[model samples]
Target: MENKVATIYKNQLQEYTQKVGKRLPIYQSFNEDSENFPKHRAKVLVDGVEYISKMTHSTKKQTEQKVAKITCESIFHEESEVESFPFLYEDPTLRKSILNEFVIKKKMKPTYNMISQEKGQSPIFIFHFAFGGKTYIGEEAGNKKLAEHLAARTAIKLLLETNADTLSPIIMSKVNSDDYFPKCSGNLQGESSSRHKRNANTNNERRNKKRRFGN
Candidate 1:
């Protein structure tokens, strides 16, 4: 009698599951005869903070051979905004040109005053260049934090203007040209002069090597 009652309950559950999704994240299905039985379960995939929950369920032996295709429809919140994520870093030139134009074209408001080297103050409008294999990453920085942040915003604007279809999460090289250019009121001395000389030497060597091996 107990087994018969269990069977009837199981059948009803299976029918309900088939009619409506399990509602709960997890659910089970079982096919019990006088001896052995078949059992199965299901789960739902989650993404970000988008939807609250999903429904799923199981079937009986009559339809056990049939596969139920899983499908999902996105649900949006009242105040939420959804946009497709762009494919960033797909092209290096697109990234470089976007940054370059931003720096050259726009004039950012001054964030700080030019300070003396003795005070060891950094300069406004520092250029950063990250070396990428065939391309380069470039950014601008001002002495003030606000100015630096402005540079990034300006760059992003210019990029959008040029390529309306560009993807999000912009990609570029990791070189910083700002470090190479510092703000000092007077003559180059000590490490400053040494760095200049080294840069000049490196440029000369590259030129000489290129001449030695013609394109």
Candidate 2:
């Protein structure tokens, strides 16, 4: 139940908005308590615009983190050349899903380009994903699939970290892969969880009020 990456993004995003004179970030989730499938998608209201994560995740934290990370990317790079990356899943299939998620969220299809270099005897393949006019290049690999994943992984790493520079030095230093995934947690997560529960309850009450008025 550790959601380290999500906590980092949530805190950094809040701090970023504060620095830029924006209101506190607001979050809402869809289908977060499914009886059978614990699937959910998170949306954030920032600067009067709503940004929702394209893919549904198994947990509320994951979905919220995805949306928050993308929202951070949008606001951080709005006036600069910096870009945002996402957390790619370890499984190859899930890793590719992250790319699809990006396309859905960004409304841009990334074109991949590959080049092969001759090694001692065989050739090594290097792949690059051309996304948002930025080229994320991967290391040379023995085959095409591995090379493609490597490139995608590199893109996710760089895209997310670019905006992380705006975070505090302590938060920026915590963005390592080992800790950025689900394996790590912060002391603030407990407070965050409570705040999210309150927000969720408020959202539900508002929805009910709307229904009552409509009826």
Candidate 3:
């Protein structure tokens, strides 16, 4: 029937869009400097904290590898004048996928996965800071952990990289545990569920009414 075909098409479209969305951030990560993946938007992990950094994109092979090649030698080499740090690709597509997964898909609760769920693996770094006296929390993920961590080493890094600077220092600097803080509050979740159920029931009733009228 036409209704069955329309439902199949909608499902297929949703799946296809999600699949493509997931690949955008990953591809943008590799093709650093493209407008699709701006550096300022990329997340950098330092110590045990994740910070946004000033994304300086490098097109050369040396620069691409620079981010992945961080070592103790480069980080603290006796000859170093300035701190040697690696570059990160800020893939916008990946970010959009994440937003969609949390905001639109609403399948997974929006939380930064500090460890691999499948393997119980922890990320490479963990750094703590303070806003006055309270603890500030941050963390890192993925293979570029070392390089990313080094970049997130200072308050300056945080200030320069994210919109955090725009927030009141009191709230922005409240260093809390990296817990799941959904943009939508937990109390509203039940209300949202109820609304969705009501909408679904309404739609089904309408469909049934249409069928009955046609018969």
Candidate 4:
């Protein structure tokens, strides 16, 4: 039973996804089974991030609304614009360049391919990379290039979250060259400048080390 409130939030989520160019919110009847009588607890996964409702509802559709409502609340706060998501606000194509900079700075090569998914639907693009001696799967679009960009965006988000603390040093070492980075503006540019200024001597030492070792 979808009520007016539920429908409005769901609609908002749909519009937000479209605006952000992400896949539509996918609602599941139950991500974790419930022992309650209604037995309808829902979850939604968008942009590889999952949101599960805390409470169960009477019907599957209601449960779906619960997840959708929560997802909407999380993404679309007081400000409802693409700019709200700074990291993801860039064009999908630019994200590829950023992802490349991150991976290449670590001297790791990413392997990309496609895998069979739904029988009638398009194949799923898959990206792979290795770090700390462990292989990780990382994507799909119409063609390889497009798929790579899409995959890059996904990988960047996941990796940035996964490597939040350690990744900064990996990035800081490459500050000697501007060629390795994509165009940045606003908060990214500001924070980058602050970091660069803070680590000026470190950057110089790393550059000198690279030169001496021919790395």
What TM-score against the true fold does each predicted structure earn? 0.22, 0.38, 0.21, 0.34
The best candidate by lDDT is 2
Ranking by TM-score: 2, 4, 1, 3
Q: Compute the lDDT for candidate 2.
A: 0.65
Task: Say what the RMSD of model 1 is.
Answer: 19.6
For candidate 2, the per-residue lDDT at 168 reads: 24
36: Cα error in model 2, Å: 1.8
Off by over 4 Å in 3: 1-188
Residue 146: error of model 4 in Å? 40
lDDT of 1 by residue, 44-100 (tens): 222322121122223442222111112122221131111111112112223333343
Candidate 4: clashing pairs of residues: 125-139
lDDT of 3 by residue, 99-130 (tens): 22222232332222222223256445443333
- Local accuracy by lDDT, each model: 0.32, 0.65, 0.32, 0.58
* lDDT, residue 22, model 1: 51
Indicate the worst ten consecutive residues by lDDT in candidate 3. 84-93
